[model samples]
Each structure stands twice: as C-alpha cells, then as structure tokens.
Target: MKLSKKSMTVLSFTLGACLFVSTAFADTLLGSGYDRLKDSAKNTATLMEKDLKNYTVEALYSLKDNDQTLLQASTFAKMDTVNQLSEENTVTKTAKGETTSSYSYSDKKLSVRKSGMDNTYYVTEYPADVNRKGPAEFSNPFKENGAAEIEKIVDAVVGSLKDYVQVEEGTDGGKVYSGSLSEAQVPAVVNAVSSFGIKQMLHDERDLPKIESDIFVKKVVGTAVENKAGYLENVTGDITLSGKDKNGVQHDLSLNVIVKLSEVGNTKIAMPDLTSAKVEKVSYSGGFSSKYVGTYKNDIIMDKDGKFEKIGERTVVITSVEGDKVTGKYSETVYPGFESEYPNKDAFNFEYNPATSSTFTYTDAKGEQKNGTIHPNSAGKVYFEMNIEVIDKNSWKSSSLKPYYDGEFRRIFE
Candidate 1:
C-alpha cells in the first residue's frame, strides 16, 4: 500500500502536533524526558487561552508497548488552530507549523509531522481529507460572545484530539494509535469555527474529502460416503480471506487477485463385487451347519474401483469339539459376496474353511468313540453340503447335512 504526498503530509503534521502539544505543558519543559515532554505538551494545549483567526501546532512522539517503543504506532501530529479575531474583520489570518519526529514502538518505526496554523492561539485539529488538494478554505471569522464561544471551539478540537492520540488494541494482538482524523471530523472543525456566536467575527471553511475501503470472505466444503462397508473415502476443501484491511491512498493500491483450484466436481467410485460366497456353520452341529453362531473372521480384497477382486483364504481351528453338538473354530478365504448379502455371507464363511478338511472324534450314547470328516465342496458358494457318519461306533448312525450361508460387505471410495 502506498500513500499520496498530501496524505503523508497531513499524517506527519497530526503526529508532530500531538507530541509537541503533549510535551510543552510539562513542569520542566526544557529538560523533560519524552514522557514528561508529552505530559507538558498536553497540559499547555489544554490550558492556553487565546483568540486568533487560525492556530496550529505539530509534534512527533514515540509510543511504547510493554516499555518497548512501537515503530508502527509512531505518527506526526498536525493541528490547525482557529480563532475569531473580531466580527469587524471578515478576513482571518491563518497560522500553521510543521514538525518531524520518530518513535520506535515494539521495535517498529512510526514517523509523523504537523503543519498548518492560524492567528488564533487556540488549536483546532481538523481531520485530513485526501480528496481535497489543499487546506480547507473558509470565508470569514466568527465573533459573537467574548470567551464562551471561543472556549466551545477550543474544547471541541481539544476533545477530539485527545480522543485521537491514544493507543488501542491492534488486530494482530499488538498496540496502535488512533490518531488519524476522520473525514467528518475535518469538516466539523471548520463548521465549529464559522458558527462561533461572536456576531462580530465569522468564518466558513469547507472540509476535505477522505476515503477508506476493505474486503473479506468466508467458505466451507465437505463430502460424505454411503453404503461403503470397510472402505473409507472422504474429501474436503477450504479458502479464506481472513479479513485484512488496506489503508493509504486508494489510487495507489493495486491488488493481484489469485484463485487456485486444485480439484473440483463429482468423483467416480466402483462397487466391490460381492457374489457366490458360501456359509459353513451356524451353530454347534455334527454335520454341515446352516446357523452361523458364535464368532467368525474372514478377509476381502478390493480393487481401485472399490470392487472386490479376490477374497483371502482363512482357516478356523475348533479349539473344542463335542458330540452331535460339535464345537470348534472355523476359518475360510472369502471372495466379494453380493453387496446386498455381504454381512450375512461374510459372517457365515468365517465359521467354516472350504479349502481344508477336518476329522473329529465324538462319543456315542453307549460311550463308544465315533469318527467323522467335515469338508467344504465350494470355495465361496452361498450354500454347501457336508456328510458325517459314525465310523467306529456301532450304535451311531450317519447323517447328511446342508449349511445355509448369509452375511454382508461394504465398499469405500476415495
């Protein structure tokens, strides 16, 4: 950001005046430190009573934050003092002064100057209008009452100045000065001088134009996936301006607007192939079981399109095996079953392994031991049959059993 020469001049003067006026009123004006000088200047500007067409003073002052000088907060003080000499003189003399000073605040540099003065000893700090080329032009000096009218003008200007020169919290969690005069304040000062009640003296001044502008923004983006069993696919994007302000000459400001979009729009995902998977055991039964009870486990592999190409082989070892109510562990390699019956198929297949054959010994009613073989005919078919017979037990009979399988699976797209 760049500032125009006129704006720079006004800002410099404003800062200089603030420092000078704040320092002049100190008890030991000649040998006072910066702090004492500021105090004296403010006191003198507060007390001095004089009547002149126009009066101005400028000063430069340093600001400190946590005992450290802040360079950015440093500014010039420029004040325009106006007084109604007499009603008899439509023409009023203008007195102005300029001062340059520097202050380091928080290790930053702030510089300002003060310019423009009038005959009146009372100071009138008007807001600078960047639009206008020169100082505000007034037609006449105002004079109605003796001291009261002059006092009001002085008070207004001083009050505004006092409010303007203080430090405030900055957006960056730092300290800043509120010394810049607003466009309205600039004209108000001029109006105050022209409206003085002393009918003998009258003055009219037009305010200069000042302008300020800024920009900001907020945005949000998110994505959701549905019916994806084990796969997780989510995407999100974001952009923000963060509310930044640009101050200075409007014309000198050049913004390079840049918008970069890496990715946008709908994404394509493939569904996992879930078909032809079989279930082995449902509950504790001697033959092929339909009721898949207890706990089971299986592995499934998916492709880029989220479709399953191959299901890993699993093996379930029965830790304990009983009689007609057989108990043991079952493990199997499961392929992608139909998407609709995934969970059921997945659960059933986990109970039995189609790739391996198992032989178990069971006790019959007569206390004789019987042997039986359990085998899976299909790799992942939904339903399969198994044959079981008591080979060594005389009283035990042979039984053929068919197991029904059911389970589910889900696909994730990224």
Candidate 2:
C-alpha cells in the first residue's frame, strides 16, 4: 500500500526571535564560512526594509505528491509605499482540480478587489490600518522576514555543505551559488533546513496536511543569484519530504518555491479601470457584535470648567439589542460641592452610525441630543469610549458641573 500524497504530514519548528534586539539587527546571522552569501542576503533584507517605498515582487510556490499536483499558488504585487497604492494578482489551484484567482488594486481613495472568472470588482475605501514595513505587509517590504529566514536556513545548510557549495560568476557580473543535499543529516545545522519547508507552510497560515507517519527530509536543492550591487535578485529551491502514511504506505511530498525581486523603486501602482467591471461602492462598518451587550459603568469627577470639583457616576445598563441598535437605560448623577446627588435617569435607545470605527446616536434625559463611540481595548476584553459626543452645551450641576466624554468601560455581553 502506498501512502496518499494528499495525506502527508507537516512538521514545523522555527526559531525564536531575539526579543527587542534592536529592530535593525534583529535577524542578523553571526556565523562564518558563508559570509559573502550571508551578508549579501542579510543586507538585502535590511536595506529593502529600511526605505522600501516602491517595489514589485513575484512569488510562486507549489506542493506535489509523486507526480500529482496537490497545491499551487502564485502572486505578483506592485506597490507604492507613500500613497499605500498597490495592485496584486494571485492564482491558486488545489488538489481536487479547483482553481481560483483574484486581482486587487488599492489607490489613495478606493480599494477594488476582483475575483471569480467574471472578475467582479468589490470596491471600498482604504482601510484604517496598513503595515508598509514588515514582511507581513506583503507590499512595500514584501515578506522580508521570509527572505531573511530563508537566507538563514540557506546559511546553515551551506555551512553543513562546506566544500559541496558551488560558486560561480553570474551573468550580471554578480555571484551564483548552487548546492544540494543528498540525504537528511542528523547534524543540527543540516536539520535547520527544516525551516525552509516549514516557512512555506506557516506562511500566511496555509492549510496543513495530516499524515500518521513521521516524515523526513529527503533532499534540498537551491540556487541563488546575487547582483553586482550585492542584492539577491532571485532565489529558487525545492524541498522533498518522504514518509509513510497510517497504512504503512510510502509517500513523497515536494514543496517548491521561487522568489524574484524586480522593478525595485521603479514600479508604480495606479487606480484601476473600474469602468468596464462591476464596481460596487462599499462602506465597511462594525455593528453591535456580541461584545457590546453588557452593563458599563464609569466614574466622572470634573466640573463645567474641566475642574475636579465634583464627584459623579455614569452607569449604562444595556438590556437588549436588535439589528444595529441597542436599548438601554443610563444614570448620570453628580455630587457637586459635596452637596447632594443629582441623578438624571433615562431609558436610552442608540442606533449605530457609520463613522471611522464605531458610532452611536442617542438622546439624553433632558431631551438633549448626543453622539459618541466606543473603542475595544486589550484584545476586545475592555472598552475605552468617547460615549459622549456633540452634546448640548449644558452644565452637570444646576449651577455648574460637567460630564466628560472618553470613559473607560469594561466587559461585554452575549
């Protein structure tokens, strides 16, 4: 019985980063023998990440069992860092003969995502958050960490190869290094080669396979070209995993990836032509998720002139919700001059509005209008809110006191 290639297992154990290790030198390798190769790749990673405001990267990776293609994917992205403009085209194929493709373009004002064969455009404004630097960005810096990690793995593997590494001059007056692994070695340095394969699987949290038998690395072959300017123009490699399935059937899974950097600081991303495609304008808004249904309480201690002359408590009890609206009751009481508690109680109904993140409009006890929002804090466990916005200019005390916005509310409901 032969183990099905589709059921191969994957083992992932990458290195731990040096915490707070001066961002610039975080992923630098301190080994010997491959200084030229290591320095060229490492410097490329660092320099590209420093002021990489424009670039185009093409990455292609695939996995196969025996002669059957289990998975294949490719991406080409062109980015403009300053304006956060980018255009990316992607393609993927699965084991079951299913294929999917997408093209996305982001400009200063609109973001269009097109998918499916017909290529319908999903248009929306730019998101509030965009990382332009990290390898995770996949744009300006375009996965620098992966490049860095691959470089380290290559160094470790090359260090183990020693005299086996073949070096030659490149066609561009650079250097070309080539090498291969015959059999998996138990040596720690050679074992680090697992990082190359593991990096592929862990990248973007790709789907992982499950195999019952322990898989081992069979062979690794790669070639990297460094330009005269000391930058890796291209890096290509393949890793083969051989093992048995649950039924003692042998299976061999191969992972292949190639990355090429081009058009550096020479690429331009422009607004896409949405004239022919189906363009849909969208407003991405966050509604009343299960996180906002509980009771919230905060204490206020300021006066009309923003002075600490009064003691107060603001409590909101949200009982129910329907659609993007919530029905609740609130108590705003203030003790001014340490005199008496002037409690203003009212049943409040707030319907969310489309704002930067989250917004709600409501009326106060004295028929005053107000608008506000709440921001989830600490992984959405607690909330910091400007629950008060654009309220009638009124004093808290009969004579003079105040209710400030920006309260720290805790907890949420189902």
Which is the leading candidate under TM-score? 2
lDDT of each: 0.26, 0.52
Q: lDDT score of model 2?
A: 0.52
Instruction: Name the best candidate (by lDDT).
Output: 2
Clashes of 2: 1
**What tens-digit string does per-residue lDDT give for candidate 2 at 1-414?**
111111222321221110000011112233221455655666677656545667788999788777678788889988666556778898888888788888877665566676657555666653545321222233222242344564454445444343333556778888876555545343444334453434343321223333335555666666678888778878777767665644676667676878898887788777777677676554433223454567776665433332344366666665655543445555565665543434454346555433322345567567876555443332223343323333222101011113333245555444
Per-prediction TM-score to the true structure, in the order listed: 0.13, 0.54
Scanning candidate 1 in windows of ten residues, the lowest lDDT window is: 198-207
Each prediction's total of clashing residue pairs, residues at least 3 apart in sequence or on different chains, is: 110, 1
Residue 188 of candidate 2: its Cα lDDT?
Answer: 41
